[model samples]
Target chain A: SQTIHQWPATLVQPVGSPLSLECTVEGTSNPNLYWYRQAAGRGLQLLFYSVGIGQISSEVPQNLSASRPQDRQFILSSKKLLLSDSGFYLCAWISGGNTEAFFGQGTRLTVV
Target chain B: AQSVSQHNHHVILSEAASLELGCNYSYGGTVNLFWYVQYPGQHLQLLLKYFSGDPLVKGIKGFEAEFIKSKFSFNLRKPSVQWSDTAEYFCAVELYGGSQGNLIFGKGTKLSVKP
Candidate 1:
C-alpha cells in the first residue's frame, strides 16, 4: 500500500516570511505529484503538478512554487507569504496510468 | 479552459430519503470522471470513479452514479441515505491521454443528513 505524509499539520506564519511544506510518498515510484490549495468554502485550486523529477507544471502563477527533488519527495515553497496565501494545502499522488489520486492529510496554513 | 459545476452547494435531507447530486463538466473529449467524499475533519476519499465501459457505476456505501456523456453530466444517486452519509462530496474530471493527471474539481456539495 502507498501512503502520503505531509508535515506541519498547522502553521502560523508572519507576512513576508518564507514557507516550506513537505510531502513524501512511500511505496510508489515515478508517481504523478500535485499541489492544491483550498480556500474556506471554495473549490480546490491546482497550484502545481509534476510528472517526473525536476519537471513541474504550474497551473496558477502565484507566490508558491513546487519541486520534486526525488521520485517520492515533493516540496511546496514560497519566498514570501501573503495574507491571501493562507488556506488548506494538500498534496496528492497518482501512479502513472492511474486516474485515482490519493491525498495526504492537509496542512492548514494561516498567514498573519 | 475546462471547468466542473456542481449544482447544489449544500443540501439537507432526512434519513431514508432518496438523494441525487448533479455534476456537469465543460470539456469535449475523452475524459475520466470521479466523485470523492470528505467526512468532517477527514481527508478526501474516492467514493467512485468512471474510467470507461459501463455508464452506471456503483461505489462503496450504496452510492451510485451514472455517466451521461451526451449531457456532459455524471449525477450521483442513493436510494436511501443515512445520517452517517453527511459529508462533502466533490466531483472531479481529468482529460484522458493528458500528459498530467490534473483533476478539475467542482465546488463541493455539503450534504447533511438528519437522523
Candidate 2:
C-alpha cells in the first residue's frame, strides 16, 4: 500500500517569514503530486502540481512555489509568507487519470 | 477555467437518517467525479468516484454516489448515516475536458450527524 507523509503537522509563522513544507510518497513511482491550500470555510485552492522531477505547474500566483526535487519528494516553499497565506496545506498524489487521490495528514499553517 | 459547485454548505442529520449531498461541475467534454470526506481535524480522504462505468458507485463507509451526465452532477448518497459520519464532505471534479491533471473541487458541504 502507498502512503503519503507530510511534516510539521502544525506550524505557526509570522508574516514576512520564510516557509517550507515537505511532502513525500512511498510505494509509488512517477506519481502526480499536488499542493493545495484550504482557507477557513473555503474550498481548496491548488497551489502547484508536479508531473515529474524538476517539473512543476503553478496554479495561483502567490508567494508560494513548489519543487519536485526527487521522483517521490515534493517541496512547497515561500521566501516571504503573507498573513493571507495562512491555511491548511495538503499534499496528495494520484496513480493516474480516473484514479482517486491519497492525501497526507496536512499541515495546518497559521501565519500570525 | 474549470469549477465545481457544492449546493449545501452545511447539513444536519441523525443516526440512521438518509444522506444526500449535491455536487455540480462546469466543464464540457468527458469528466470524472469524486466525493471526499474529512473528519474533524483530519485530512481529506476519498470516499467514492465516477470515471466510466455504471452511474451508481459505492464507496467506503457505506457511502455511494450517482452520476448524471446530462445534468453534470454527481450526488453522494448514503442510506444510513452515523455519528461518526459527522464531517465535512467535498465534491471534487477531475478536469476531463480533454485535459491533463484535473481534480478541481467545490466549496464543500459540512455534514453534521447527531447521535
Candidate 3:
C-alpha cells in the first residue's frame, strides 16, 4: 500500500521567514504529486502539480513554489512568507492508471 | 476555462435525515467526477469517483452519487445520514484525455448533521 507523508503537522512561522514543507510518497514510482491549500470558504485550491522530477505546473500566481527533487519527494518552498500564505496545505498523489487521489495529513501553517 | 460548482455552501440536517449535495461542472469534453470528504481535523479522503460505466456509484460510509451526463451534474446522496457524517464535502472534475494534472475542484459544501 502507498502512503504519503507530509511534515510539520502544524507550523507557526513569522512573516517574511523562509518556509519549506516536504511531502514524499512510498510504495509508488513516478506518481503525480500535487500541492493544495484549503482556506475557510475557499475550499481546496491547487497551487502546484508535478508529473515528474524537476517538472512543476503552477495553477495560481502567489508566494509559493514547488519542486520535485526525486521521483516521490516533493517540496513546497517560499523565500518570504506573507500573512495570506497561512492556510492548511495538503499533499496528494495519484499513480498510473489511477484517477483516485490519496492524500496525506495536511500541514496547518500559521504566519503571524 | 473549466470550473466546478457546488450548489449548497452549507447544509444543516438532523440525524436519519436524507441528504443530497449538488455538483455541476463546465466542460464540453469527456470528464471525470469525484466526491471527497473531510471530517473535522482530518485529511481529505475520496468518497467516490465516476469515470465511466455505471452512472450511479456507491462510496464509503453509505454515500452514493449519480452522474447525469446531460445535465453535467454529479449529485451525492445518502439515505440516512448520521451525526458522524458531519463534515465538508467537495466535488471535483478532471478533463478526460486532457491534462491529467489539473483536477479542478468546486468551492465545497459543508454538511452539519445534528444528533
Candidate 4:
C-alpha cells in the first residue's frame, strides 16, 4: 500500500516569512505528485503538479512554488508568505495511467 | 482550458431523503469524471470515477453517479442518505491526455444530513 506524508500538520508563520512544506510518498516510484490549496468556501484548487523529477506544471499563478527533488519527495515553498497564502494545503499522488488519486493529511497554514 | 461546475454549494436534507447533486463540465474532447468525499478532519477520498464503462457507476457507502455525455453531466445520487453522509462532495474532471495529470475541481457541495 502507498502512503503520503505531509508536514508540518499545522503551521503558523508571520507575514513576509519564508515557508516550506514537504510531502513524500512511500511504496511508489515515479508517481505523479500534486499540490492543492483549499481556501474558505473556494473548494480545492490545483496549484502545481509534477510528472517526474524536476518537471513541474503550475495550474495557477500564485505566491507559491513546487519542486520534485526525488521520485517520491515533493516540496512546496514560498520565498515570502502573504496573508492570502493562508489555507489548507494538500498533497496528492497518482500512479501513472491511473485515474484515482490519493491525498495526504493536509497542512493548515496560517500566515498572520 | 477546462472547467467543472457543481450546481449546489450547500444542501441540507433529512435522513432517508434522496440525493441528486449535479455536475457539469466544459470540455470538447473525451474526459474522465470523478467524485470525491471529505469528512470533517479527514483527507479527500475517492467516492467513484467514470472513465469508460456503463454510464452508471456505484461507489462506496451506497452512493452512485451516472455520466450523461449528451448533457456533459455526471450527477451523483443516493436513494437514501444517512446522517453520517454529511460531508463535502467534490466533482472533478480530467481531459483525456490533456490535463497532464491535473484534475480540475468544482466548488465543492457541502451536504448536511439531519438525523
Residue-wise C-alpha lDDT for candidate 1, range A30-106, written one tens digit per residue: 98999999876777889999988999999999999998999999999999999999999999997666588899999
After superposing candidate 3, which stretches have Cα over 4 Å from the reference?
Answer: none
Per-candidate total of colliding backbone pairs = 0, 0, 0, 0
Best by DockQ: 4
Give lDDT: candidate 1, residue A46.
90
Tens digits of lDDT, candidate 3, B1-115? 8899999999999999999999999998998889999999887889999989999999999999999999999999999999999999999998888666468889899999999
Question: lDDT of all the models against the reference?
Answer: 0.93, 0.89, 0.93, 0.93
Q: Worst lDDT window (10 residues) for model 4 chain A?
A: A92-101
Per-prediction fnat: 0.71, 0.57, 0.69, 0.80
Chain B vs. true chain B: TM-score per candidate: 0.98, 0.94, 0.98, 0.98
- Angstrom error at residue A94, model 4: 1.5
> Per-residue lDDT for B1-115 in model 1, tens only?
8899999999999999999999999999999999999999999999999999999999999999999999999999999999999999999999887757789999899999999
TM-score of 4: 0.98
- Pairs with steric clashes in candidate 1: none
Off by more than 4 A, model 4 = none
| Tens-digit lDDT string for candidate 4 (A35-75) | 99998788899999999999999989999999999999999
Models ranked on DockQ: 4, 1, 3, 2
Instruction: State the number of backbone clashes in model 2.
Output: 0
Weakest 10 consecutive residues of candidate 2 chain B by summed lDDT: B94-103
Model 3 lDDT tens row, A4-111:
999989999999999999999999899999999989888889999999999999999999999999999999999999999999999999654758888989999999
What's the chain B TM-score of candidate 3? Answer: 0.98
